[model samples]
Target: MTQQNPGSAPDEESPAGDPWHAFGYLVAGVAMYGFLGWLADRWLGTSFLVVLGILLGAGLGLYMTFARFNRPPDPQSKQEKN
Candidate 1:
C-alpha cells in the first residue's frame, strides 16, 4: 500500500486549504464598508456613520465567513465515499 503525504495541500473545497482567502474577504469587506462610512460621515458631518459602517462591515464579514466555511458537503463529494 502507498502512503499519502501528510504535508500535501488540501483541495479548494476544504476550509483548511485556504485560510488566507477567507481572511482577505473579511478584511476587504471591513475596509470597503468602513471607507464608505467615512465618506458618508464627511458628507453628512456626522460622527456616528463611521461607527455604524464599521459595525455593519464586521457583521457582514462574519456572516460571509460563517456561510463560506460552515457549508454542507457537496453531493458529488459523497460519491468518493464509496
Candidate 2:
C-alpha cells in the first residue's frame, strides 16, 4: 500500500547532494593550516612552512572529506526497509 520513490531512497544521502560542504572543508583546512604555517615562518624566519602547511591542509581536508562523505549505506537500514 505504500508508494516509495524509485531510484532514490529516503535515508540515502548522496554525496552529490551538497558540493559546498566538501568545498568548505577543503578551503577551511587550507586556510587554517596556511595561517599556522605563515606564523611559523615569521617566527622561524623560514619561507617553506607556508607551502608545507598548505599541502598538509589540502591532504587532510581531502582525507576528511572522503572519510565523512564516502560512507557506505548501513546494511541494517536496507534490511529493515525490506
Candidate 3:
C-alpha cells in the first residue's frame, strides 16, 4: 500500500492553469475597445460611433469567453504515476 501526499503539486501548469488568464484577456480587449469608443466620441463629436465601438468590443469579449471554456485540459492530466 502507498500513501500520496495531499500537498503534492497539482497536475496542471500553474501559470497557464489559472482560469483568470481568459478574464484578463477579456478585460484588456474591452478596455481597448472602450478607449477607442471614447476617442471616436471625441473626434466625431457624436455618441453613435462610440456606441458602435462598445458593441464591437462586447462581441469580442463574448467570443473570447467561449474560446476559454472550450479549451482542452492541461497536458499533465495525461501523465501516469508510478
2 or 3: which has the higher TM-score? 2
TM-score of 1: 0.74
Q: Which tens-of-lDDT digit does each residue in 1-82 have in candidate 3?
A: 6664566664534343346766776777778898898898899798777677767877898788778777786565545343
Q: Pick the candidate with the highest TM-score.
A: 2
Best by lDDT: 2
Assess the local accuracy of residue 59 in candidate 3 as a C-alpha lDDT between 0 and 100. Answer: 80
- The CA lDDT of each predicted structure is 0.77, 0.86, 0.70
For every candidate structure, what is the RMSD over all alpha carbons to the true structure, in angstroms?
Answer: 5.1, 4.1, 5.1
Query: Per-residue alpha-carbon lDDT of model 1 for 1-82, expressed as tens digits?
Result: 5453476443434443367767887888889889999999999999898888888888888888788778788886555434
Q: Evaluate model 3: give its TM-score.
A: 0.55
Tell me the TM-score of each prediction against the true structure: 0.74, 0.77, 0.55
